[model samples]
Target: MRIILALLSGTLFGAGLVISGMADPGRVRAFLDLFGRWDPTLAFVMGGAIVPMAIAWTVQRRLESPLGDKAFSLPETRGIDTRLAVGAILFGIGWGLGGLCPGPAIASLSLSPVAVAPFVLAMFAGMGLHRLFTR
Candidate 1:
């Protein structure tokens, strides 16, 4: 049941991304191009993305356990660190340049127009290297 709920949640998220025009790199790029196109659609999409997570956090805080778990499986770290800084810098640079992060990049992969495949592969490689080096 939990697995099914997870799948359903993911499907809903991906569908929301698609419907919000966030599944397109062109749209994302336009959003970043403030001096040029300056799309406001991304703002609305960000609001949509945040609302559910915010609500989930609020609800989970009130719960002792979730679904089949004895307790929530949450992040262990709560401090600022080199890993966080480096990741943020790299993410900001890539986002400013390409206008897509892992989630949207994966969502946009359905376009399969040859450009996004390399970006997604490089993203995976970067993530792997981050884990290996950080450890």
Candidate 2:
């Protein structure tokens, strides 16, 4: 089922994060602390991810349809605008400060990390506020 596969994917992703030393905030911060205890490994990690993503995206672009679907489900965005920019800015700031975005934070929390609670709480609160504003 899709749900089972989704869960498996999440588990795999979490394991990869742990194995890659990305779950540790110190390692991530050190990677970002260029010119001071700089570590370029994070760049390599990102690049590695990008390679697979790029290939998948390129392949997906040419696909006419999935096994069951009539056509590919895709979003049609008009253009990048203020809302997108502001949201990205907030996301970037949060990622920089916490060193754990949603996926990594949620995964790390499963390891009994006390640190992810606030970031997760704030993320939920922000989501609720956004829903309230949009509705």
Candidate 3:
């Protein structure tokens, strides 16, 4: 049941990315292009996400356990540290360079597998390297 729910959630998220034009690298790059022909679509998309997320967080405090889960597997730490800052910096650089973050990159695979494959593969490789170095 949990696996099915997860799959469904991922599919919905991917569909949203595609529908919102987030899966397009050009659109994402335009959004990031400040001082140039900057697009505000991504900002709007993020702003739209925040409302639901804020509501979810509020509801989470009242819930004993998440639906279809025994417990909430949330982050244990809530601190701004060197690792977090470094990771955020790296993520921003990657997003700016590739014009596609993880969610959008994966969602784009179906649209242009040949073009997106490298980004997805590199993303996985980066994740592996992070785990290897951290562990």
| lDDT per residue (tens digit) for residues 13-113 in model 3 | 99999999999999999998898999999999999999999999999999999887999999887889999999999999999999999999999999999
Name the lDDT value of residue 15 in candidate 1.
Answer: 76
> What's the best-to-worst order under lDDT?
3, 2, 1
* Model 3: colliding residue pairs: none
lDDT of each: 0.81, 0.82, 0.95
Q: Report the C-alpha lDDT of model 2 over 43-78, residue by residue, as the tens digit.
A: 888889998889989998888874445677878977
User: Lowest-lDDT window of 10 residues in candidate 3?
Assistant: 71-80
Error of 2 at 23 (Å): 1.7
- Model 1 CA deviation exceeding 4 Å by range: none
lDDT for model 3, please.
0.95
Preferred candidate (TM-score higher): 2 or 3: 3
Q: Identify the runs in model 2 with alpha carbons over 4 angstroms from their true place.
A: 58-71
Model 1 TM-score on a 0 to 1 scale? 0.83
Candidate 3 residue spans exceeding 4 A from truth: none
RMSD, candidate 1, Å:
2.2
Q: What is the number of backbone collisions in each predicted candidate, taken in the order shown?
A: 0, 0, 0
Q: TM-score of each candidate?
A: 0.83, 0.83, 0.94
All candidates: CA RMSD (Å): 2.2, 2.3, 1.2
* lDDT, residue 3, candidate 2: 69
